[model samples]
Target: MKTARRYLASEIYRTTIAVILVLLGLFIFFDMIDALDNLNEKFTFVSLLYVQALQIPNRLYDLLPICVLIGTVIALAGLAQRNELVILRVSGISSKRLLWMLWLITIPFMIFAAFVSEVVTPYTEKKTSEFTISALGKNSTKMDSGYWFREPVDDAHYRVINIRRLNSSTEIDTITIFEYNTQDNQLSSVTNAAKGILQHGELRLDNVTTRTLTSNLAQVLTNEQAPLESISSLKTQKTISFKTSLTSERLVATELQPDKMSTPDLLNYVQYLEENNLQANRHIVALWRKGSYPFTLLVMITLAAPIGFVQSRKGGVGAKIFLGILIGIIFFMANQLALNVGMLNNLPPWLTALLPNIIALILAFGALYLMERRSKPRNFIHAK
Candidate 1:
């Protein structure tokens, strides 16, 4: 009996994974083609293909939760059609036990999704960004005035850096620095440079200007420009590149924004965000979404069970699954809406991120309970 149960579960799981993969493949193909059309302005055929290929992991990350739902639904529904779940019930598996068993099957996939979110998505995004820039004949991730960031030490001194652009390959340009006295609440010094370059834990500034303020009352001012300075003495590697510096990895120790960060980077960024008093709401919600994503897959599976169990009238499991897709669509819309609202309203990112799952989970579980409960045991277990 145990062996039978195991076999039944394995078969369903395999089929579900297969269906999800096929769907994901189709989605990627279409999406890449659409993206290529947009990149036509900046990329050649080969570069466009390379950039899009590097972006597959990101696409897969976005589609994983829905794939989980669809795949689980189809496989479980097939089992229900074969009366395998009935056999499990007759063998003394309670509905809750079955649900738990389904959840157990879901755990690994959830973990995989999380892994992709943390390790795969961010790497691909960074690579994608790099490839895009290279194809466009530019270097650096630095945006206009490049990257701007502030750091504080002892509330008496802090540094600010302005970058013009970050090249595709970790190059920085148009660097400016300001060191201010927090106690005096005045700008202590200003450094302007033609460019800033970072390499191997060292920063080099070209065409530099240094300004010094001599009094608390702001009476004395001195300014000097040095064409070059190596700022390796600051004890902080991040002050050179904000993208690498303010990355989610440096903000936290764990893979906080799995969907948005590679694991190693996510951990650091999370730590940095907390230290800087920056709002991590959006990132936090993404973390929770990764955790809850698997349950959504199980919900999709549960939805499929009843559809496949019931014989096809005019609209069959296909229609039901279509409905399931609609549900997924609605769920995504709601989730995105909540995220935007949360950001705008300063609401908790975690709550907004989980809203879709919470709503779906409730509906899925309630429907399953009522449907199973309302039906007679024999009818529930066996076909008409």
Candidate 2:
């Protein structure tokens, strides 16, 4: 049993590594082709290649589950074609025992996936984004617009800030802030700055213009009454400093994305958003998904196990491989669909993330059970 397990592990690992390399090569080639249109005098072909190299970790992390499935199917089907699996089965190795061995062999892969998702991918993704933005000489934009943040001033007031462009974590341009009275939800003031600097938990606004509305003006605006004369006072300052919770690290977290964030960073960001009463559904979903990623590898292997149980006379290895690829695509699509549906309906984060995997596990186990039942009579006859 030990020898068989070792042999199975080695075969799966070898095939998985080969599959991952081929997939990565294909992905990088396509990415290089797509990056051609972005090349310029400053951003040359070499720079483009470097950027793609930085992105390889993230791509590998994304492709690991699919590669595992395909690799396992190919390895197991090849073994079955050579009658190795039949020999092992006839030697008192139950189908359930074989399934358990497959799951056991997947532990190393699960650990690798977890490490890549939690450590390597986040750092590489951030560097890729920063490098691309710097090379292109532009500000980073999120969701086709500027980065928006909400910060609480006190019980009675809160501020909404918009930055049109971010050159770096510490530098921003076209800053806009709107302060509102929490009691009446009335606009109290507006501040606009040409540029801003963040340092040591302090935000310094340069060339600032602030408009403050008087109580009467606020009432008038709330009542839809037009004021003929100037009702709000405007003030200009060369530079103004304020202590803020929006540190450079948090700014970078906001600028990149929730999915690109490490688990700890994503957790902190989600808490910050919830505390400020900001929308954090997407981040919450991403956090749950990240937490469940390791189990996703196990699920992929389970889905591939039954495909290898088919006899060589019934189906060729090519057909089994095609089936494996089809199942992998379906699993990917189902996961994405569940995420969107869960977000749209405001479902629980854990449920949204694990739904597809749970469903796949059930289907996989059922298929395994059927295969075991079908093989039992043959085993009994051989023993007699």
Best-performing candidate as measured by lDDT: 2
lDDT for each residue of candidate 2 in 248-315, tens digit (9 for 90 to 100): 77877865667667998888888889989888999988988888899999999999999987777754
How many residue pairs clash in model 2?
0
Tens digits of lDDT, candidate 1, 331-352: 7788789878887897776677
Task: Provide the TM-score for each candidate, comma-separated.
Answer: 0.75, 0.95
Clashing pairs in 2: none
